[model samples]
Target: MAGHSKWANIKRQKAVVDAKRGKTFTQLSRAIILAARNGVPDPSGNFQLRTAIEKAKAAGIPNDNIERAIAKGAGTFSGDNHSLEEIRYEGYGPCGVAILIEALTDNRNRTAADLRVAFSKNGGNLGETGCVSWMFDQKGVCIVQGVVDEDQLLEASLEGGAESYEMTEEETAEVVTEVANLEILNQTLKDKGFQVTDAELRWIPSNNVEVTDSDQARSLLKLIDTLESLDDVQNVTSNFDMSEQLLSVSVV
Candidate 1:
């Protein structure tokens, strides 16, 4: 594992634990609501909504809750009037590592205040828009599970329009593609008999800062964890890499 993939693995593990506790249900529901509100409520007609529904289901969110969220998003449910806005916050972490945060919030001021506190307390600073965004590129990523034949996968990736592919782990492969080609790539891999477990748009770092110091690694991980713990936050990406040993102990 390296850089984005390493952090993604950790986040995936954390998501499982969070799902078990039902902690991710709120975020998942919010995502569903936002996706529905932004487009048609029918997943078949709306790709973002479909993706949100898939993620919600994978997180163990009940079908009833998902339906209610869609209703709320479509403005058919009169009980809720909260209008959520998607916002991206960029910043610098310990050792000048770039960090990007995606959040869904009803209160921008509150979210910003919370993020500022998290950053300042963790040796980081919340930066202005586009401050660190230049260091990253938003790309579509799909996580294919199970051991796969490299030759076959390579052929499928090429035919599917994937930009590149990497084996993040022995049984896990990460496929990258343009945003427009994600759906095609996902289906292509599935048709080719690959188990596509996860797919989403992500901010990938163009460069990674090597953190050799254990203290910096700990601080960076703490900062990211704190940011992710926020209710309004949806995702966090950073341009930092560290040794596995340092990463293990750093993420208490």
Candidate 2:
């Protein structure tokens, strides 16, 4: 597995194990409502909404809350009178670790002010919109158990239009595919009973940057934490790779 990719997994586990339940619920609900409002209310018709609901389920979000969010978004229920906008921020973390922050906000100015402070306080600075976005390519990412039958997976994923599949002995496999084909491939794999860890659109780094020192590592991790704390920040992606030792300490 890619070093950074492994670190991301570790962090994800940490989130499930130690994160505040309410915060996770709020974030998941926001994602569901936003996706439904912007795209389609029916999960079957909206790929992003489907993925958001799946993720919310994985996080233990209540079905009632999920449905309520969707209704509010679809305008069948009372809403709090706020509009959401998808925003992206590009920047460089400590040691020049390229970063991108994806946010869903009701107020751009408030979100921007909070995010700028988060970056500046953490030894990083937010850049102009296009500053670092060009360094990344949007792609479909699927991580599954590495122990799954490779031959069967290769055949199924390929036949389902996957671009590539890579594995590690740690029971983890990373599958890549064209962004446009994500929904078809994900639905097919899930229908065939493959254990899908995560299926989503990700901003993949065109080239990775390695962080070699403990000081730099500490700084980059700090920056990640800051960006993650924003209520409007749905997810943050970075190209900084972590060492095995760092993986032991950095869980999200």
The most accurate candidate by TM-score is: 1
Candidate 2 TM-score to native: 0.92
Q: Model 1 compared with the native: what TM-score?
A: 0.96
Query: Compared with the true structure, what per-residue lDDT tens digits does model 2 show for residues 1-252?
Result: 455676677667778775567767878898898878888799999988988898899888889989988986786777467777888988888878889999988899998899888888877888898998988999998877745588888887887799888774366777889998988888777777787777888888888888777767877787787788778888889987777777555433
lDDT of candidate 2?
A: 0.81
How well does each candidate superpose onto the true structure, as a TM-score?
0.96, 0.92
Give candidate 2 regions above 4 Å deviation: 249-252
Please, what are the lDDT tens digits per residue for candidate 1 over residues 53-142? 998888778899999999988988877879889999999999999999999999999999999999999999999999999999989988
- Candidate 1: regions farther than 4 A off: 19-22
Q: What lDDT does candidate 2 reach at residue 157?
A: 87
| Candidate 2 RMSD to the correct structure | 2.0
Candidate 2 displacement at residue 147 in angstroms: 3.0
In model 1, what is the error at residue 141, expressed in angstroms?
A: 0.5
